[model samples]
Target: MTSSNTTDTATARREDPPTTAKKKRSRELIIAQLIGQVALLLAIPVLTRLLSPAEMGIYQTGLSVALILQPLATLRRELLIPFAGVRDARKHRWIGLGFAATLSGAIALVALPAWALGNATLAETLLATALILPSFALMYVENAFLIRHSAQGRLAVRNLVGGVLSAGLQVVAALILPGAIAIAAALLLGRAAATFVTVARRTPSSDVESPGEKKSQRSISAILSAMIAAASSQAVVIVSFASLGPSAAAQVAVGQRVAGAPASLIGQALTQIALSSAAPLIREQRPGMTSQLRSLTIRTGAAAAVTAAALMIGGPLLAVPILGPGWEVAGVMTAVFAVPLSLTLVALPATTLLIPLGRERLLVSLQTVRLVAIVAAIVVSSALTQDVFTTSIVTAAVWTLAYVPLMTAAFTATVAHDRLCAQVVNQSSAP
Candidate 1:
């Protein structure tokens, strides 16, 4: 009787709703993501002014390439951060630190060849990458752990500190160095400093024991599985951009960024809050989760629509003076892209359903298909029309429209499966 009572108590504790403390954490997480995004948006104009298009093109391309390598090095250990509902902080800290260290080493190893490449542009890119790649990769686990632990406020602060400091450094460097490579290199260094400070201060310094006394806590198979899932999911949009020429890709990327900026800023903070609170919500099958998701979708869609309308009509007029003459197209792209991007609010939270359901492998499969389609569309479009802009616009529109539906469907399927399993368990327990 006592053992059964203890089990019930443990289950109840895990199934509790978002407490006042957890709500506060969520707010903090959302705020951090927004602050960082805003910093990125603000820094763009200054950075653009300091560097030429060609240099910007090289830097952007290098970033795209680096992103492909990022998931590989991290091997998806960061995803474990948000999965902390099942584990205690002590365990999370050790594994998280181990993951970060291992990922950093892997990134450095991968970056060496690019840094050694003889081409000046490649050399500059490799140098910039050497400074920034490890920092970006390292932050993943910290960010995830913070979200998992319901430390949203701390996470936000970390992101806020990193973004603001990095942006400030980039601006300062641009003013002093005033060149593409110099500015890029400076930006990398700034980001590194910010990320280092945040993780080092927040994460506990310790190692967890592996079952087999292996150097790493998680097995290679588990790590690789997670990495593959994340990599496949991240590949679609990023790889699509890479296949397109830098300038053309940059234009759409700019529009996508603008469209996503507001929501992303808002949602990121919410994401932290949501993830921290969501574990129990899922465990109890709380109605509030669905309600919150619905609310988010409506809010995001409405805001995106308004922003899109404004950009579409006022875009050309406002853009000409600010971005230069030929750049008016950016405004149009922004308008076209914003509405679709806004749907991310709905898609992102719904997608979280997969995490709690342990349907990560399925999610990865869906994303793999999405990426393949994106690449195929770009390739076919490019072959049909030699113009990069045309190909980009077509590809962007397709992706933007499809994002919400795909995620929504995926979540729905997951929810259905969970319900069926729960029903079976209830029947089995019936006396």
Candidate 2:
């Protein structure tokens, strides 16, 4: 009886660990990411309440410049995470090296030109922010590593530490220093700290190589594709601000920031899981998994849309007291902005599907079209009038109108491609 009991216990242990463990880890990641995002969200309202609009404007402008330049530093190597496992280490290293070098050089090259063009403040801030791009890129690389290793727990911890610390520091700065620059600096410092922590925890693998070497044809293609996509996406935001006035642009951006927060955090977190788990699916060429992914995308998109609507309707009432007096207008706009912002969830999965399928160029092309649309709308709106609200409406309409069909098609195509590939491989291997 004793022997049988021991055998049963050992058998139970071998039956696979409790689902609770994975659920707990996943929950932690979601919570941590949310905490970080909530911190960021809080910063805006708090800072807006404390500081002048002009000051907030300055900070927002700085952030815009940072966003544009940061991607330039990456050259999209971070996007390679999903497919990196299938490639050679040497190739991956070279790709990383080339991007890092290109990004740094690109920043330096832009400095003189930007200043010569008389945008010194924007240029200088961009340059300073550019310095951190490498670190951000590195953090992304580490993120890929953690995801690939199924270390979701560690990833959650890293994000939590960074998010919570940044939020706390921003609160302190808001109360103590109460300066936009100070707030910006605090955020950056927290980012740096998080990046360092992530890097420290990542143990180097023998397969991993430093980023500097002769590039492979595949990697070269990947880089070019990602660059185009990155450039297009960045251009839209830049044009949106340029086309509409800063105030309108800021409000629209806030909507995107707020309404899209859940999708961005949760969707992004899922991408890591998707990348790690999808490997076997890809290897096995499982079409059913793609269906599952599409289902998830749809469900999430619906949820995002509903959430956006709620925020749009409820945001004004919520904002009056929470964000203080000055942000009443912004709060109102935020809700209005949520209508278009909801599409982001649908777009996320569609965009990510290209990565594992090695069709990143498709993403690039879609975004390129989106950028062209943005630019055209801006030009048309500007020609008609300098009305910020009108321009914003036009821009939002353009964005929502353009991405839906494109993303749906992209998602469907990825599923079909996976299914077809599986069939072909299975047929070829048949006895």
Candidate 3:
């Protein structure tokens, strides 16, 4: 055999293991997401049967509030782990816990106003936020650490166990108490259990030291961007609850959960894989980084489009049967929601690139605009029509119009930055 052929064969052998490992990890993540989605799907019918629309609205409200507040508690420091050295990552974990504790205390204080005003539901939501935030933050930090260590199998186990346990507990809660608070407590306990298992399973080898790294200035931007993004996503339900009442809010919540499920599942699984695999490449200015980003964008976008089409066609037909009676409006709302959900899913994989590309300012600006646009749509719709279906259609339309242009800009910037990085690398390596 020629020397060139032999050298090429040797290089291929060296590269094979990392390629194989990544594939295995990707499969594990996808399987884990599937299990979680299945658990969620199974629990929905039972929960819907056990709780009335008003009660479900309360439960969903509590969940939305928790999600909006969680980014504040964690400050998104966990997202920095993969890009940080080991010591920095460990420090981030502790710092994140501190943030959670401080935010919990602040949330407790906020609950006092609702209690004084005799707003029982609002007060309960704030109290639940205080209790759940710490556990959720801990779980996020641990999961981020797992990603940093390439412990995808452990992360998969964490998700599988946590998802099933949470669903089971919620079912039991519905059977006994059938209240929003009870179900919320079940969620808190589930998160705590997940964090406990993650901590216990941590291996010493995962703590290997690496070179020191500079502290990130974008932590606040990350937190703000994530917080706004979460609020924007949940705004429709929250606003519907306040303006149109529980019944409308319930429809929006159910529609989002059911119609957005497939896109969310695939987006989340691909997000994990992208963070683990693509971060290092971007960090090191490795070749094929842009290609990887482009490929993931295409794959996720296609899956999202297909899922949205199916939901638009079949969601209304199946909603009544799957979710039981009185949820017919939810079916129609599902069709309305599919478009914006698909757009968001298409942009999901590219979001993590913002920080690595030093585009945190752009990230925050885009999210802020999105939140503003969504809120404006809700307000205008409520003022003009005050009908749940009308509100949903307007909100979805506004979201689609706003997101497409913004996300196109984001994608364009990401590719341009990647090309610039390649240029610099080529310039440095030239003779």
Q: Which candidate achieves the best TM-score against the true structure? A: 3
Best by lDDT: 3
**lDDT (10s digit) by residue, model 3, range 131-218:** 6677578667778877878778878887777777878888999999997767767876876786677653446876665433334657
TM-score of 1: 0.74
- Alpha-carbon RMSD, each predicted model: 7.4, 5.3, 2.8
Q: Report model 3's TM-score to 2 decimal places.
A: 0.90
What lDDT score is found at residue 226 in candidate 2?
A: 48
Give lDDT: candidate 1, residue 32: 72
Candidate 2 TM-score over all chains jointly:
0.79
> lDDT rank, highest first?
3, 2, 1
Clashing pairs in 3: none
Give the range where candidate 3 is weakest over 10 consecutive residues by summed lDDT. Answer: 208-217
| Model 1 weakest lDDT span, ten residues long | 208-217
